[model samples]
Target: MIRLQSLTYAYRKGAPVIDGLTVDLPSDRRLAILGAQQSGKTTLVQLLAGLITPSSGSIERLARLSFPAGYQRGFRMASTLGQNITFAAKIYGADADEVIGFVADVTGLGAMVDRPLRDLSVQDRMNTSFALTYALPFDTYLFDNTFTVGEPDFRAKCLAMFEARSRTSGMIVATKFARTASQFCDCALVLIKGQATYYDNVAQGVAAYEQSLPVAQPKPAAEAPTGA
Candidate 1:
């Protein structure tokens, strides 16, 4: 379980991005964080992962969470994909061989695993990174709007991988779409403005989110030409 107390964050001389909020996140199931653009979803995820410090208040994390999966920022473009995996596994104390093997098999990197990251195409690199994300052990996995990346087949495979992980680990996925939330999550956390509401059922939360979205207004037809 994670406890968030009076959480607040703000940039310098700016309005609060996350205002006085408190919630308990129990790591027992999948949770979808639903939000519109700039709704603080990414900020909240980073705070929970201990990647960023909240400007005020506190967070108590009692479980280990993987960094945003397929996060390629930490990878060195000059090194081989396998080299990167070996280094990360050492950092997390996971078996390097197992992770490397998994990445090779899932991404079809095979011998390319021994090649430099600079040599792989962007698509291959992305696939490899995603495979490596699932190769580690964590109590819960974290994601930040990464569900639609790559080709359709790759996206489908990644979703399947997430489902497979769900059987043993927890996941917190942040997305802007209610459909995406309802598709993969049992519960939902909706972030509107700076406030949040946690719904036990995905349907309820999706309804709340849909209600918040602005309805598109049809354009008025051009006025008919006035008779001279």
Candidate 2:
């Protein structure tokens, strides 16, 4: 389980992104986080993954957590894919050979697996990283946006991969994709105005998100000058 108590964070003083947020996420469940741009969704994901520290609160983690799949973390641009995979497996006490082989097969990078990450394109890097994370074992997987990783067929492949893993592992997905949240998540959190609203139903969360959106004020109509 992961718990946040009075969590608050901001890039600069006087302007907070997350304000006194509190939530508890349990294992073996798919939880979706929904928010508009700059609403602290990414920041919350990072905090939950222990990537960044909260400014004035606490985060308690009781389960093995994976880095948000799309975020670059433990990779070296100068290192080969194989080398990074090996290092990750070693740190995690996993079998390096098996993890490396699995990532190579899943990424389908072929002979390029031995090449430096700097030589790969952005898409290739994402594919490689995605495969590498999947190769490692963890209780919960955090994903910023699962659909952003690959092409259509590749995204489908990733979906299949997650479908298999979901049976055993928990997931926390932060996304703007309503379809993805509804399809994969049983619960949801809508982040708005530096606050979070929890909902048992994903659709309800989506509705709340829509409702929380700032409404545009109507322009005042000009009238005849002083009733001339």
Candidate 3:
């Protein structure tokens, strides 16, 4: 379970990104966070994932949470895919051999796993990283709009992997696409003006989000150039 109490955050010299938000996130469920670009969806997820601390309030986390599984920033650019996986397993207290076997089978990288990260193609690198994430033990996973990233076959495998993980772990996925959110989430939270609107029905949440889009006001007529 994860609990937030009066969570608030703001950037320096900027309005609050998340304001006085409070919520309890229980385990073993998928939540979709909906927002347009720069709506603080990423910021909220980072707070939930323990990547960043809130400016005010506190978070009580009881689950072993995985970082954004779709992220590749943590990889060692100079090391082999296999070496990276081994290092991750060691850090997470997982068996290196088990992680290697899982990554090999899932990514089908074969001998390429032993090659340097710099040597692999983009697709191979992404697939390997995704596989490596599952090699550790985590009760919850964080994702930031990473549901799509590769070839059709690879994507199909990723869908299957997510489905399998859904059976046992919790997930918090942030996405701008309402349809995708409805497809994978049991509940949704729409972020607007640094506040969250909760909806049990994913479709309703999407609808609410659609309704909240800012209507562009017409620009005022350009002032005639004043004579100097």
Candidate 4:
């Protein structure tokens, strides 16, 4: 459980991305954050994961929440793949060997784990980033549109792993896609213009988000013969 009180964030004194948000994030089930672009979905997820400090207000986390899966901010480009995994495992209190084994197996890196992260191919980097996601365990896992990683086959593997883990771990997914939310989440949190509204029903939350979209202006009925 995470309690947020008057949470707010702004970019360089610009309008707040997240404004005065105060609510308890559910950890017993999956909660999908539904919002259009620039609606603070990612910002809220970051705050929950403690990746970024809020400009104002406070966040209190009661459960151990993992960083957003596929987040590469922790990667050390200069370090070897094995060394990076070892460092991350130590930081997250996971087993380095286990993490290393998982990544190497999935990426076919084997002994190549000794290679620097910068030397790895794009596919290798993608595989390792996701492989490391499940290498550690947390009370709650956070995701911000990180479902697909690496090649299609590797993505399938990641999905399989996530499905197994979902049975026990809490999940919070931030996405603008309705299909993603309906497929994986039970409840939804809708964000609009920096404000948040929680919905017990995912469909209802999606409806609210869609309703907030700017409606296209209908073409003025071809001004039929105005003042002749």
Q: How far does residue 124 in candidate 4 sit from its true spot (Å)?
A: 1.4
Using lDDT as the yardstick, the better of models 1 and 4 is 1
Regions of candidate 1 where Cα sits further than 4 Å from its true position: 225-228
lDDT of 4 by residue, 20-131 (tens): 9998888867889998887888888898988889999999988889888888888989999999999999999988998899888877788778889999887788778877
Best by TM-score: 1
State residue 101's C-alpha deviation in candidate 1, in Å: 0.7
Query: Which lDDT value does model 4 have at 209?
Result: 80
- Which scores better on TM-score, 3 or 4? 4
Question: Which of candidates 3 and 4 is the stronger one according to lDDT?
Answer: 4
Better of 1 and 2 by lDDT: 1
lDDT, candidate 3, 1-228, per-residue tens: 888899999999899999998988765688889999999989988898778889999988898888777668778879988888888899888999898999899888878777888898887888887777766778987888875458888788778888888898987889988888988998888999899887877888889998999788999999999898
- The digit string of per-residue lDDT tens for model 1 on 189-223 reads 89999999989898999999999999999999999
Give me candidate 4's TM-score against the actual structure: 0.91
lDDT order, best first, reads: 1, 4, 3, 2
**Residue 60 of model 2, lDDT score:** 87
Q: How many pairs in model 2 have backbone atoms within 3 A of each other, for residues 3 or more apart or on separate chains, i.e. clashes?
A: 0
- TM-scores for candidates 1 onward, in order: 0.93, 0.88, 0.87, 0.91
Candidate 3 differs from the real structure by a C-alpha RMSD in angstroms, to one decimal, of 4.8
State in Å the error of residue 67, model 4.
Answer: 1.1
Best prediction by lDDT? 1
Model 4: pairs clashing at backbone N, Cα or C within 3 Å: none
Clash number by candidate, in order: 0, 0, 0, 0
